[model samples]
Target chain A: MPEPVLELDRLVVRYGSFTALHGLSARFAGGALGLLGPNGAGKSSLLRCILGLVRPAAGTVRVAGRDARRARSEVRRRIGYMPERDSFVPGMSGVRALAHLAEVCGFRPDDAMLRAHDVLHFVGLGEERYREVAGYSVGMRQRWKLAAALVHDPDILFLDEPTNGLDPRGRARMLTVIDRVRREHGLHLILASHLLPDVERLCDEVWVLDRGRLKMADSLERLTAAARGAKRVRTRPEAAAALAAAARAAGLVVADGAAEAELVLTRPEAEVAPAEVFALAASCGAPVLGVRPAARSLEDAFLEALEGD
Target chain B: MAFRATEYERFTGRRARRPVWWPVCTATLRRGWSSRWVRLLSFGALAVAFGFTALFYFAYQVMPNWPTLLRVLGEDEGMASGFPVQFYAGLLHVFVYPILLPLSLLFGHDLVARDLTSNALETYFSRPVSPAAYVLGRTLAYTGFLLLTTLGPMLWIWAFDAATGPQGRFGEIAFVPLALIQGLVPVALVLALFIQAVSSVTRSGVWTNLAVIVLFFFGFVAGQILYEESDRPEVVSVPAASGGRNEAEPAAAAATTPAQAPVPAEETADNGPEPTVPADAPPRIRPDRLPLALLVGAALALVGGDPTPLLLAAPTLLFSGDRQDGRPPAAASAAVGRRGPPAGAGRSADRRPAPASPEERIVVHHDPRLLAVSITEVIRGWCLGCLDRSYPEEVRRAQAGRRHRFRATEPRQVPVDLARNVLLGLGGLSLLLLFARLRRQGTVG
Candidate 1:
């Protein structure tokens, strides 16, 4: 078996008297791992600890099977970190700053420069690469930071709040770029973000942290599989309410779908049958257009994980 | 135009450790060099050095008898054979005060301060660099520019002077090259460390520059006030009340004697006929009350250099003084500040013979240590003393002969040396603290 990309053995992090991470122990082999938590939930602290920016109060953090604290330079060289806050070298153009960071990561000058250009282009910053980063807009700066993180092409990427200050369009573009990188390069990703949809789109596994403790660590498939047997019923908007009422009367669990003309029906004891959903729609005089298996939003799984502890 | 493909390709090139600090250092240098003002100032420093060299050559050629006059007066011994050590001292003084200090301030004001303000340290620390390596890279960048601006031009001037002057001039000042290193390297280190420490604390480049300027100005003013208020009889005028006896004895005595003889103010009128003081003579302006540029220009004029180089050197030395004090100007000493201090001036091992009724005597006194309060004087003194201490016996004699003009009896004093040691210790401590703070911040945050 291959070694885990990151191995945490009872890792603890504290700032003064405040403990940020309490005995975080996990092993991530290699995959897109989403870290979900609310504010002050130790998501950033875990990232920092793994990146070797913060020393563990006790236990150890290993990156690529090397002790993070002892082999900090090696660990940092192997992992690329995008900080939660806006960070860039002042007075430097986007491409030059990216190249400078690539060089600092031990890339040869020519290779670093070439990688800088390529990464900037990949992040959709090729047009504005010549502009000083200080003058870049908020979205541009975020993209530039992403380019800086990717310029050296490390084995793992720890992106802290990658979509923090981005607009909706900008956020989608960023996610697309990140998804492409993950799919094409096969790099291990540890993405910490508050946006659930973004995580659901990119990450296959999830670690939920709350108050510095790991609440749940599981594959996304297993966590969201509970709601998969439920059936979604889509009917005329005028008859959706009647269909929901009819389903509830028939001893079936009924809930609103994500849209106005959609109704979700489930059974607690058995698989929710599409025939039952269709029968309820017919009885309610609703023209049923579709009856399909429903998938639970990751938000449900994330919130449940937070409350499950 | 055809569209070019812009795609992200895998970087298959090999990566290796070539000292991570090199990128940091080169980036810093590139940023500083990109500034138009920095380029202008650097070029201006070199040009001024060239102009000064030309002026010195012209002066020597115009007044062929001046060397003989200096020898007869015992002011210097090597003027006919080689450049006097005092000339080098004066040039070093000019370089440190007018050239290097401002250039460093302009170039390094934002070195670390901006990174902290803009939160760029995260990006830097995210790489395979420790805080120590980052600080080392920054200090090296600053020190490299300092050497380029000051020491580079200094050597160029020396070579130009040697080649242009009479034959064998190079061999006469062979110790100069080594002395320059002894002098400049420490000063550069101290300045770089000090500025880096300051930059670490300040959040803005403007604030860093302001803080440094204010600290230097206040220290200089405090030193000047302390010297003026103290009762030490350090000032020695050329013409004295006691028929030149007071002048020659004390000047010679101050060369080797540590203990000083004090002459009170009232005793001068009894010894010599009181020179009449005009009631309307303009008051002597304290040098601290004058803009630093004017003082630099005045110092240049006092050295009898062409004033054209003043245009290059003056504007950059722009420390404005606060002259709110309403104290009446005293007599006979205004010229003292205008020209170089009389022989035996800064040494306290002399009675100044009461300054010949205060109106007749030119009371010239300046402690080189107190000038600018930027450690420049200490560096110059260290260079001179280093030459004396490090040279062979024969070379020492030669240096002693060349140094007869300044007559530095004991260049190193216990108190001033203690101050220098304290300053150096503080600078080193600050750098260490900066390293620790940066690491801690990076870690905890």
Candidate 2:
């Protein structure tokens, strides 16, 4: 019911003869939305368009209901952007750079400095905040960029490849910071990344894009739930046949198994409760060990969406 | 002791609205001022200022009792008295041209280039700052440095002059500060915007600096060439009745005549006198075919009466040669004495008149087309000359002396004109606009 943080209406973007985005229209609600796309899938281009760095060839882009073209400065003031690339002044110290950017964003010098320090600490770069950005390691630079983005404390954060170019541990740390920003600060996040697990871990909704077109846009729960057509039930080999028969009689499609059996439910887990499964098992006189949804991972879903187009 | 928790705190304090360009301007200034080369250049500028100040102070103190100082030094009294303005203008020319212009390259070379190369424009443009603000901030930063080098020393000298000079001279030199600002600010602003514009086109600081240096040197060299070519003389033989020259004499006699001829190139190989153009030699441009309008325009502009021709010749106008004192170069004067029949010497034989005294037999040669060009040059020289208010009168007297010999001397008062100031100011503004447009296009980023 809250206004969408970002809305694009029939937005078309072209670079020379190559069209990067073709009539792309979508509304990103105020929450963590994953902008999932492969390389060259117009993800970065869309983000740039939202930030007003690249003008749309057709249609309109609005941030918080303000036209980005007409009220660019006002729109930018309420949004924080961490570009996918390394985008810091090379020779400047992280804190100084953040403070300077904050000042440019319309903060007083003292307030900018104080906010820079606070954000640096918040992003877990408190000790290394004084070091020159050029000398920072990849992980450190990522954290520093996050700090800079948060320094102004905008309404929404546009993070492009937030976990890009990081080791496993570094990636985990970055994701944790992103998650914290969403949960603790309660700021809307539009995270553009190719790593589906990263998106699934932090995002409430996912927007899958491929070849400059939106293939799917839905909540993570609904997307994964729809992909999951069946649930695998583990039971004693002797009771498997009886369970299968019982599941079939209950309007559930059951698959034959050598050692176990699979149950294709008539409805989603959200629609049908787990109590029904246990009751069916008791009626069939079968001992149930465990039951799990047999659905494709988010990565599989993303790839399937791309291939579907 | 009670256990305390450490965590990130949100800054909820009162936020004030700061100027969008403040951060960019301050950061650029801090970086430029902290550069070792910039610091060294600043010291050098201050050193030059101190040297001038010391000279002025010493002259002020000693000129009252030293009655023979002007005579012995062979310097004019006006120059001795009006040294502050002269020194200020001279220092400005030196600083703005040779020093500050190149130093601006160093100061602004990386301003926009670094942002583009490092992808920092994404971060900057994503903020609330607009492209115009970015350009304004960079220009201001470079202009601040330029002012420090060019105007900063002028102010120092003015203050020192007022404080240390004799009582009455301070009021006489009061206009020095205004003149310095008028002459130097436009040049500084132009250089700053020009360099920033260059910086915005490339991602390499070295390349930007090189481009700026090349542009400056090219403009200067091209201006000098055009000015010299515009001043080339036109030779016209005066009638024997007017200047008393023999018509029967061979035209080559003008070059061979011992007393009137120039010192031969071989004789003047060392430190004798500069070799003169032979009087009989054809003029660089034929007088009959001269572009009269261009010549007249150049002359009027030079005299500050009309600026149209000077505007047309703007490339060469600013580099007009230095002001000439009354004393003519020995070679020019020597060349003046050699005279023969005019161009088409054979046709004038029948119209020859009887010869007169040697001094009266002088030939007159002037470039009618170059009159404006020469006047503009002379005016520029006089405007920059150290003779104060008497400079124009001195130039007039020199023109009168030349006119007595039937040589062309169009005496005209040449003040610095408003047209020139407007042209230069427009040049700076155009560059600023260009830089802003480039910024809006996101060229540098």
Candidate 3:
């Protein structure tokens, strides 16, 4: 098997006596892994540790099977990072900063410059080569920063709130750019965001962390199923009781709401699809209603996991 | 394969290309210079030049004749004042040029340290540039800015003298560069070194610049005390008189033996001498003292170069006409054949090589032990211990010139002198701690 792109074992980070990361342990396979957390939940800190910016006080962090804290330069060379901050080398045109950053990443100056130009063009910044970064718009700056991170064509791209502080259109553009980088390049992406919708849209797997501890790390499909709520169906009055009785007979948690008919599927996604309930309802001679799929979102799961319900 | 190749060809043809780093280096340099502190420092340097020019002009007015002006400058009137043209031409060469007050203590404070306090250091360092390159490149830019601010007024004074004044000659201008080398450069160097050192050791520019202000001020205060002590060791028991004191009693003045004996001449009992002359020049010997003061002026201009403690220590170093006190400003580099009692003594033995060797230019102040500790700190900072196999023993040896000498002299007895050293240690330690903390949390990765 190919090695995990990122591995963390009991990692901890502290400031003075206060801890930012409390024994957080996680290992991620090579794919788009969404690190979902609320603010101050250590998601950004985790990405920094992987980037080798923050050294773990305890345990180990290995990026692409090499110790990240130890072989930081090597690890840095292999990864791209888009920080959430608006920090940029001001007074520089977009192309210059990217080129220099690439050079620092071990590319020869000439090749690095060429690669920087290519990436800036790729990110739609071809014309602003000499324009200083200080004047870039919020969206333009985000794109420029993206160009810098991608200039080296890194294998694993760690994005910290890349959509943050962007206008809706800007956010959409950023998402498209990030989605392309992940899809077209087959890059391993570790995206940290408080927005569950973004994770749902882009991530194959999700790792939810709360208060510096890993709440859950699994495929989005698994997490949603684990936290699945009662499956609701809309129907006329007569069939509600029959459908409720049959759902109970099938050992599903039955809830007959005043406004709708519902069946709570206790089994996870693998056991059954919500469509199966229609067949059960039909066979039991219950009047038919429109059947619907299960609804158990990452948001629900995140809250459930954190609240311990 | 043919169709795929055709598509690849088309893709390559479509790509738009341009020069890179247009944004990076330019942006980096701009943010690096767009600092308020830099602007403030530059203004301060200008203000200082103006202040000095005003003071000197007033002094020149009161002592219209060369004889009287010489006395105001504190010299023996009977001694050769180099030339009347030479004496007035090279006012900056004397210890009281007024340039040192700003460039050394004010403008030089912000060079490297400003980046750290403004939080621009981490932003710039994150790019692929090495620390050494960053320092050199940035230092060059800052020094250029400093030179312009400082030398601008001196040029004006030169131009004014050339157009209208009695000592107006082309040769008079040679004194400008000389004064720059002697009276200005050492102080500039001192300012730059301390600024950089403080910046290197502190993560914040405010603290680093503040550290410099405190260090330079204390150095000034300490130099005053040292000057007093060196001149009249007997004065140690005697309390210093208030109001003012004689220039001859200054430590820098004490270091030089009487040249041609004290030349006797009448005090300038005329036209209420230069208004800006120190309140206590006795009005008479101010003219006589001028030539004596002017005597070492040329020698001073010839010798003083870099004031970085190590640079000043080399053989046959330049001398500073240091008015404030402390070591004489000269080419008195302390290549002291590995002697003691000379940290900033900056004195060196006379040793010239037949030919330049690999280490010829390198002054190796050998300390394997200090280097060992610094190297270990670097290794640990990089987490190199994880890979036990390392470079060979000989290759691991550090360059000899960059070791620390922790042994400081009379720091306890001389609290002010010890203050800077103690602060340097503290600044270094704090940076280490911050770096370590940043390492663990991964912000610096």
Candidate 4:
């Protein structure tokens, strides 16, 4: 019953003639929220509108119960944004640049400097804090950006493609740092990423967008839990329709699986046994090629959201 | 203590309501002052100030005893007695032209452009600072340095002049500081905004510096060309009056034109009298040319406060060859002493003047000084000359209102002072709008 961290009211964003967000309306309660979409899906545009960078063509965006447009500075003060691109003040040491940004965000000078050092330490840039941010390598710059975002200690954090372009070790390090920040600090998060596993590991809620439309918004728990008691059935491409019909006729909830010629069958009240799935396919004049349990995963939910009407 | 990369720690300290632009201004100052070129130039500016003060002191002390030495140094007879108005004018020229100009170039090239090149504007706007505040902070940083270099030393010299002069000299020259401020502040503010605007366009420090250098070089080159061309005699055709047949009518029509091209005095002396067109003679076809020299001179005048450039620009505007008919006259040297029967000139010849009408005559009068002096210089010089001529008596008058003197006689120098003021005002406004646009596009796009 606390105000949702973000409330978007039929938000419409356009760049010249092209619409980026088509009347998006949603409310995100405070928690780790994952925004999942492919390229040009308006994920970054939505972040920009929330950050007060892009003015909406129509409708309103509210952050923490304040109008994002009217109260932009106040709203921005409570939110830290890690942009998708490599951004930093040139000619400044990493620590000094972070401190300058913190000061810009209204932090006391001494406290800003101390917080800058501490955040750098937290993000594993403590050793390179004295080096110019312009000289930082790809992974180091990513860590430095994360450090900058955290230096202000805002209430909500917006991370745009945080793990982008990172090697395996670097990606793991970034995720670990983000996870620690979210879990230990109890900060609210609105993380926009294309990597679903990264979301699954950190976020409890998800919003899926495709081509400027919000396809689904729900708790990650329920999205994945809906796949429980389901079996993934793979058969010949020609037998897909017959197997799906058979499973539906058996009073099971059936949907398309993530791969070709596959059907996922679930019963809301009970478990869907693989042997039962095979029997249903066999009786319906469909070949029972393979049967396996459909484990809970965000990828299935995400792809389903994209695939759904 | 051993270093450890650990969990994130929240900042628990209190926040302050410091002006958001403070950090930006300070950062700009710090970065610019940290540059080796800027520091070295700053010292050079200081050294120039000291050297000028010493020169003025020595001139006042030694020049009085040796008029011959004063004459050798090109010191007019009046300057040998006391620090004249030229003292302040000379001070402004030395301070702005040599010391502050390059210093500003070195210090200000990267102020805004570096942020753009580094893609830091988004990070800046992502904070609480507005575009206006960002621009203001940058301008303030550059303006502060210029004022420090310009007004700071000028005032020191003025005080030195007041202290070292003969008794009661302070009362005579009390208006010098006011004049310095009136002249210097706008130059500083305009330059600060101008460089930043240039930076926004070029988006690189080195390129913006190059652009500034090119613009100045063009101004210098254009000023020289205008000066040479304006030094020549020009031929122009006067249009006959609409209904009048008297001599005054044509003269009145000619007076309406912005400037009258002067013929060489020798040519006029040899022509015996102003030549009249016979009614039977055919008129020549010619058209009026736009005043290119005046415009170029006015534009170049906006760059400096020394007034010498303005003086140089004025003659070009007034006397540049604007041939109304026939092929462009050969250079100034070739056109002299050629007095032939008048050819049909100007489209106005179609409305043929009656044989008895004096308007049919082509009158040419020449003043040797037109090529050497601009109308603005004439007016400004007249004001300054009046002050210099009346120096012993008009000190009280000068003290009462020397600042308003140029503005009061604005009708005389309209083409010069007005154009300079309008260009400066428009230039400042355009720079402001450019900064806003840069911020708006930078943030979202």
Candidate 5:
């Protein structure tokens, strides 16, 4: 209804003659939009476009109701950007870097210092804020980067691969921060991630990219539901054969004795009643110890989409 | 619209504060002082100057028989040595300044160029600071740096000389303060001019700097062409140098001795049977009514080095030195014009009839006062310098006659070389352009 937070219209990015992003169109509103893609799929290109750090050849980008190509400074002021690669100003203290970002965003030194401290603390950088980023670990550096991007208190955030190089626990912490920033700050977010778990937990919608094209863009629910009939049911190691046949008869795919074989489901996307699966397991001769919805997997969706294409 | 405008004006008033100039200047000064290369350059400039000064100091100390240092600087010395003030002035004009001209490149060279190269110009251009501000900020920082590097050495020399020892009554013989101030003025002028000259090429600081260096390496000739265009083409055109036009103006004066006037060592009381220079009340020199006028004239002459700059300065020196104690103006001017066999004119064997002699010279041929003034006029006005313009056919024929040893008219001539002036003029023009480019890039994005 109202103007979307971001609208990338047929954006084409070319490096010389080779187009990196070939006229891709997409729009996002005030919610977390997850961008899931393989390497070289122009996902980072999309975020750069939103930040107005890179110009598109063919189409326009409307960011926060302004044409990004024209009112770049205005648009950039409203959007916080976290680059895919490390953009740390090495040799500067983490707090200092945050302060610089705030200053660049028009904060005075006193206010910038105070805001820097707040953002550092928000990203769990508390006392380590005084430490030089040169001495920081990958996880700490990653958090510091988040603090810089957030210090400006922008309305919309563009993060390209926020969890790309983090440990599982680090990735989990980042995801929690992202969700909190969105919910508490009422900020719109774009997260580019390869790990589907991050998207499932943090995104309100998803954009699946493969080979520089938007192969799938829909609500997270519908995106997963499209692959519903092929969901696998996990069973105990002993009764894997009978479990598979019965699941096949129900138009479901069940892999035998795989990891997490203690749970069973008709489809990964189905809203299964856990207690029902728990009770029906014994009669099928594959007693289920527990049951839950199968995690949505971008890898599987990506492979299947590539095959379909 | 009225209500919104009123509110906007109030908001603007609240936020329109900017930093004061001194703090900005101090910040700029600090930036340059702290730059590693800048530290090296400033000290290097001083070390070079000190070396030149020491050579003079040592020559005075070791060879008491050697002529005073001023003669060498004044172009009167048969042998070439150095003068500290003159050497200090020259190092800047000749070496340090030409190099400093292009430093504006460090700031602006990255302009329209590096933005496209790094894909970051978008980020820079989007900042509230405009392209103009960026360029101005960069130039401020760089020129401030140059001042620190150049003047820092001079200040040290002045302080050290002032603090330390000097044996005799020339009040420690330390021209350091004058030399120091003079040292900086020319450098600042030259660098300012060069910055303006080279600024139009690119938005890049490095390229502007590089262009300056490259121009210097090949001898910047474009400005020479410009100079040729601006100057009276028929006048004697010495090669233009890039720096220190302010301090080195007196180096070529032919008549009146400069502030550092060379008194021959042989003429010293030690060797030539003392002609008493009274130690007690310091030569009872008469006060001229126009000392300030003379100083200003000296300064102008030093800047342009035209006879006007010198003649205006020389009157008092002549008035003070003309009489034994007191005399009438006409007789004094004539008495000083007398024949003492022209200083450094040559052996008796080289003598021929003096050509183009002053009417004032025949009666007062023995007086030194008239001699100095007459000679100065001849050097400034009648010394034809070039073939196309700097010298006239008369000078050429005279030069040709010097070879023959016998010629028609037997014309007495005063010779000043034209080729050297052309070389200096061209050199100066090129250096100015180089600095102009540097300044432009440093100033505006």
Candidate 6:
């Protein structure tokens, strides 16, 4: 019902003869949308186009219902960007760098300073805010960049590899903060990353890209749904063999593992039901703990999408 | 205390719409001042200012007793009375060369280069700041710093001079501050933008500083070389001979009828009688031939035909001189006066028949090479030497009878005008080029 936060119509970008993005036409709804792509797959280029940092060779980039090329300043005002690189004003303290960026984003000096302090605290750098950015560790630098990006309170936060180069704990902290920003602050988020699990955990929708082309754009729920060929079953260890036999006798393919059994449901999922499985389990005199749709992981879905392209 | 309460709160407070450049300008100024070297240099500038103020105070205290003081110091009376304009000129020279130039170069070397190397330009331009605003902010930062060192001290010295100097002369020198602003502002702006433009292209601060230094000092060195070579004896010999011949025709005719001329005894006593030339000898050249040739060459150079002198003395050309006294150094005055007939030419006509006229009394054999050497010496003295040393011995000879009015013609004024035009043109062109380069690089927003 609401306009998409970012819309690209047949966008094409090139540097000399090497095209970074080719005819990337997509509409990202106003929610968490993960931009999944391998390195050099035009993920950064696409984000740059959406932010109006790079001009599209062909087609249009509309951000918040305005032409990004024509209304660049207005568009940028509505969006916050955390670049993948270590970009910060050198020799400046964390608070000063954030405040400077906030001021450039159209805030008064005092307001910017207050907001910088607030954001630095929010990003878990409250104590280190006074230290120069040069002295900050890699994780702290990432947090500092996030604080600067969020200091302006933009409508859409464009984070390019927000968790890149972070240790496991630091990555978890960053992910948690980003998730909170999206859920609590209620701002549209475009997360660009190569890590599939991070995307699957945080984003509702996923747009997989490969070789400058969009492989698939759909909700994570729909993308990783049951592959329409198998059902996984959980039952007593002694009952797993009997359950597989019953499943086979019921005209479904079955494979038994050590703890559970998987049924290759020859019949469509529309026709198969939990009641049928329960009736079969009773006849076989086996206890059935649970039966659910077996779906591919996000990594599988992403690799499959790229494979199809 | 803890900022926990405000953490993760959206900054919904009303945002203020300030000029985009103000934050950047303030930040740059703060960063620059935070550096220890900048603080030290600023203190040095202040010390120089106070030192000058004290010097002026002491000079004024001894003004009434200048004759006795001059005797005690074994200095000429001219040095005491000629304090206002020349003194300010020396002060300006010291400020620009040693203090302001180095400080500006140091401040500007990293201004843009750091942004580029650290990729902060993306952060800056990704926001509401435009390229023009970025440039304006950075340029203003350097300009502000340079002004603190330059205009601040200059005004301090001017205040001391106005208070200690004669009241009647105050009106004349009152505009020195204005001249300084007009003169130094462009110098500062040009240096700032020029350095910024260079920084935009390179990522190393050392390289940027090197480039700026090379540009400023190399231009000065090259200009000095060109000026020396162009004003050399070989280049002026033929011109001086022709100039001498043109003057000799009228001078020889006056010398022939000595009975009709009844030269005054006082005039003859003051300047020994001019030597008579044999009718078979070549035309005699006046001792002032070399200075005349230099004056002519400098005038022709100003008309856009020749740029040797203009290029060499660019800084001197752009200088507005001490506006308070209205009398720039004599060398500058003479350089500017080149377009008109030579100074004291009219007086030469009236005294020509006297045979011992101060102008004709110093005649020597008209050798083209020798005349060229004379012209070369005068130009070298005026162009490369200090103001006191710039006056040619020929001009000194003519001033022997009227030492009270001696003013060495300053050739720097010619280059000053030329330098202004050249710098303005270069600044405009460099700005355009910088804009285009930034656009092409597409590294901003």
Best by lDDT: 1
TM-score of each: 0.73, 0.69, 0.55, 0.76, 0.49, 0.70
Per-prediction RMSD in angstroms? 11.8, 12.5, 17.5, 9.4, 20.1, 12.8
TM-score of chain B of 3: 0.39
| lDDT of each residue in B1-445, candidate 5, tens digit only | 1111100000011111342222223333443454456556555666755775675467656764343335343445342222333333344343344334433333223333433332222333333333334334444555556555555555554454444324431342244345344434444443443443344334455666776566554432432332222122122111111111211111112212121121233321122221111111111111121233344454555456343754655445523421243322222121122222111111122222222222222211111111111212122211121111211233334333221211111012222221222222322542433333332232211
**Candidate 3 displacement at residue B8 in angstroms:** 14
Q: What order do candidates take by DockQ, descending?
A: 4, 1, 6, 2, 3, 5
Instruction: Compute DockQ for each candidate against the true complex.
Output: 0.50, 0.31, 0.12, 0.62, 0.02, 0.39
Which 10-residue span in candidate 3 chain B carries the lowest summed lDDT? Answer: B1-10
Off by over 4 Å in 6: A228-294, B58-83, B215-217, B231-409, B412-414, B429-445
Candidate 4: tens digits of C-alpha lDDT, residues B362-423: 34332112221222222232333222323333553443332212111111121222223433
lDDT per residue as tens, model 1, B277-349: 2323333323222234544554554354345544554544432211124222221222222222222222334
DockQ of 6: 0.39
lDDT of 2 at B398: 34
Q: Indicate the docking level reached by candidate 4.
A: medium
Shift of residue A209 alpha carbon in model 6, Å: 2.2
Model 6: lDDT equals 0.64
Number of the top TM-score candidate: 4
In the predicted model 1, the residue pairs found to clash are: none
For each candidate, give the TM-score of chain B: 0.61, 0.56, 0.39, 0.60, 0.37, 0.60
lDDT of 6 by residue, B27-144 (tens): 8898788878778888899999999889767877767444235333433543323233345556667777678777876777787778766778777767777778887887788798
Q: Model 4, residue A64: displacement in angstroms?
A: 0.6
Model 6 CAPRI quality? acceptable
Q: Which pairs, if any, clash in model 2?
A: B298-B372, B299-B372, B302-B376, B323-B381
Tens digits of per-residue lDDT, candidate 1, A100-172, equal 9999999888887777887887888878888999999989888888888888888888999899888999999
